[model samples]
Target: MKVLGSGQYRFERVESWPNVPKYFEMGQPSDVAINSSGEIFVLSRGKHPVTIWTPEGDFIGSWGDGMFSATPHGIFIGKNDNVWIVDCGAHVAMEFAPHGELLRTLGNKNSASPTCEGRLVHAQPFNLPTNLAIAPNGDIFVADGYGGHKVHRFNSKGELLLSWGRQGREPGQFELVHNVWIDSRNRVLVCDDENDRVQLFDTEGKYLEEWTLGNPSGICIRDDIVYFAQLQPFEDKSNGRGSGSISLYNLDGVLLSSWDNTAGGNKDTLIGPHDLCVAENGDIYVCEVYGWRVSKFRKIQ
Candidate 1:
C-alpha cells in the first residue's frame, strides 16, 4: 500500500478512488465535502457540476447541471447536510438541498463589488467569493476572494451583518481571503491565502492571531483538529512539478504534521491542493485544481 505522512497522521492512498463515470469528465474538482450520511460531494467545473458518491467509492448520482455558472469554486456541507457552493465567476454563493433544490442565493449574479480599482477596498457582499462557513449560531461567513480582500458575514436569513478586512500585510488586513471555517469554539478562521497564513478572528471580526501555513487555500475543522490544503509554495514554483501539501494543526494553533513531496513520485503527494475535507471516520479527501484530481487517503495511524 502507498503511504504518506508519519506518526499519528500517516495515511494510505486509496488507488483510483471514487470510480468516475466513463461518460463524465471531471474537469477540475475545485472542492469536496462530506455529508452527515458519509456521502462524498464533489463540486467541480465538469459536465455535472455536483457529483455524489459513497464513502466506498461507489458512484451514487449527480446534481446542478445547468444551475451554476462555469466556475464553481467551493463546497461546504452544513450540519443538516445542506450544501453551500460559491461561484467565483458568477460572484455569488448559493445553498441547495441535498437533492439539488436551490434553497437560497447570496450576492448579485455576475455583479462584483468595487475592488479592482485599488488593493485597499472594503466592498459589499461579494467580489468573486470563494468559500463560506456557517457558525453554530447560524451566522454565515464568506471569504470574498480573487478580486477582493475581505470577509463578509451574513445572518441565517441571508441578510448582511458585517464585513471586515482590507488589502495589506497587516494583522486584520487580508490579501486573498480564500476560505473560511468556524471551529467549535466559535472562532472565525479565515485563510489568508496570498499572505501565506490563516487569520483567527472573533465572531465580531476582531483580530486574534495568525498561523503561517504555505499559501493556505483550503481549511476544514473536524473535532479539535484543523486541516489545511495549501497551494504550491512560492519558493518551489521552479520545481516544474509544483509543490503543494496538507497541514494538520491542533485547535490551539500548534502544528501536528505536514506532508508533501515535491518530486511527484508518491501517490500521496499533492499538487495544487485547493481544498480538503475529513470524513466522519477520519478519512481525508484532497482536491488539486492544477493537477485535475482528487486523492483519497485512508487513515492508517
Candidate 2:
C-alpha cells in the first residue's frame, strides 16, 4: 500500500479500489460526489455516465444512459441528496433525484451562448459550464469555465439570477473559471485555474479574497477544512505532464498539509486530477480525466 501524505492529513492509496463489473468500461472519469448515505456518484464521459458505488468500492448501479453529451465535466450531490451534472459538451446542467429521477435542467441542450468560435465574446448562461455548488438555501452557483470565462447563479427553480466574470487576470475576472463550492459561511469559492489561485466572493459575486494554489482544478469543503485538487503545477500547466497534488487548508486559507501523489512513485502518481470529494470520515475520492479512473485515498491519520 502506498501512502500519499503526512501529519494530520495523511492518506493511503487503495490499490484495488472501485471494482467495476467485468463488462463495464469507464471513459475518462471526471468528477465525483458522495450523497447523504455516503454512496459515491462518479460522472464520466462513457456509455454509462452516472455510476453509483459504495464507499467500499462495491458497484451498486448506474444511470443517465444516452442522456448526456460526449463530455460531462462535473458532478455535485447537494445537501438534500439531489445530484447535479454539468454537461460541458452539451453546455447544460441537470439535476436529478437521489434515485435517478430527472428533476430539472439548466440551459438549453447543445445550445451555448454567443461565442467567437469557442472564445467568449460576452458573459452568458453557459458556454461549456464546468461545475456547480448549491447553497444551503438551494441557490445554484455554476462555473462556466470552458469556452467561456464566467460564473453564473440561479435560484432553486433554475432561473438565471445573475452572472459575473470575464477573461483576465484581475480579481473579478477569470482566465479559466473551473470548479466552485459554497462554504459554511455561504461564501462563494471559485477555482480560477489558469490564474493559479482560488478566488473568494460573496454570494452576490463581490470579490473578497484570493489564495495562490497552483492550478487548482477541483475544490471541496469538509468541516473547517478546504481540499483542493491541483492540476499538475503552474510551471507545468502548459506541458500537462507534471504531478498534481492535493492540498488541505483551513477555512481562512491557511495551508494545513499537502500530498504529492508522485512522491510515492509511479504507482501512486496522479495525472490531471480534475475533481475530488472528501468523505465524512475524511477519506478522499479523486477523479482524473487523463488517468481515466476514480482512485480512493483512505485517510490513515
Candidate 3:
C-alpha cells in the first residue's frame, strides 16, 4: 500500500497487523467494511471467497471459497453486526456471523431464469446483484446492478417483498444501480453509477428525488453526512492509477467537501475506488478495485 496526498489526508500503509498471512495475495478488493472490533473485511472480485483482516492490515481469515459465480461486489456490516456478502456472479446475498459462520443465504443460484410470485416478479436473470442496504427495522435492499438494472427488497427473513426499475438512462430508470443505502430518515439512496447520479426513493420503491454525481460507485451514510466514492469516468484523464475521490453531502443533498489523494503531497493516488466505510472515530476506509488496495483517511475539522 502506497501513501498519497498531504496534510491530514496522507495515506499510510498499515505495516503492523497481527494475523495477516505473509503469502496471501488478493485480487481487486472492490468493497470493505469494519466490525465493532476494528477488524476489516474486504470483498474482492478476484476469487470466489472474500478476505478479512485487522484494521492494521493483517489478514485474519476467509470464507465462501467456491460459492460465488462471478465476483463479490458490495458488502455491509449490519446493525446487528452480521456480515452480508453480495455475490454478483451467483445473484444471491449470503449472511454470516461476525465469526465467519454461514447463517443464511438468499436468491437462486441460477438467477438467469425468471420466476413470478403473485404480483411480485422474482427474476433471477438479473446480472450482477452488487451492493445492499439494511433498514433500521431489518428490511434489506439489494441493488440488481449489472444485468437486470433493478432494486430488490426483501424482508428480514429473506422473503422477497418487491422489485423495481429497469435498464434505461431515464429518470426512474437505472442503467446500473450499483449500490444502495438507507439514510437516517429511512430514505433509500440508489447509486445509479452508469447514469452518473443518485436516486432517492421511499421504502416502498417510490421515486422521491435524484442528484448528479461523477460516476459514483459505493455509498455509505454516517450520521447526517453521506459519503460517496466518486470514480470519475475515463474521459477525465486524471493522473495516478485512479483519482479516487470522496464527496461529502448533507442530508438535504448539499455538496460539502471533496477529498482526493491529491490532498496530501504524495501521488501514489487512489484508482477505481469502488466502496467505502467510516469508522466511529471519523476515519474513512476506501477500497479500490484497480489499485488492489484499501486507503484510509481521517476527517479533520
Structural similarity to truth (TM-score) of each candidate? 0.94, 0.93, 0.85
- Provide the overall lDDT of each model, using Cα atoms, as 2-decimal numbers: 0.86, 0.86, 0.75
Q: Judging by TM-score, tell me the better candidate of 1 and 2.
A: 1
Q: Candidate 3 lDDT (Cα, whole model)?
A: 0.75
Clashing pairs in 1: none
Poorest lDDT segment (10 consecutive residues) of candidate 3: 112-121
Question: How many clashes does each candidate structure show, in the order listed?
Answer: 0, 0, 12
lDDT (10s digit) by residue, model 1, range 158-230: 9998888888889998889899999998899999998989999998999999988779999999878999998
- How good is model 2 by TM-score? 0.93
The total of clashing pairs for model 3 equals 12
Compose the digit string of candidate 2's lDDT tens values, residues 123-181. 56788889999988989999988766888889998888888888888898888889999
Total backbone clashes of candidate 1, pairs 3 or more residues apart or in separate chains? 0
Q: For model 3, give the RMSD to the true fold.
A: 4.2
Per-residue alpha-carbon lDDT of candidate 3 for residues 41-119, written as tens digits (9 for 90 to 100): 8777665356777666667788766666657787899977899988887777889987778889887665643422212
- Rank the models by TM-score, top first: 1, 2, 3
Superposed model 1: Cα runs more than 4 Å off? 117-122, 233-240, 262-268
- Scored by TM-score, the top model is 1
Pairs clashing in candidate 2? Answer: none
* The best candidate in terms of lDDT: 2
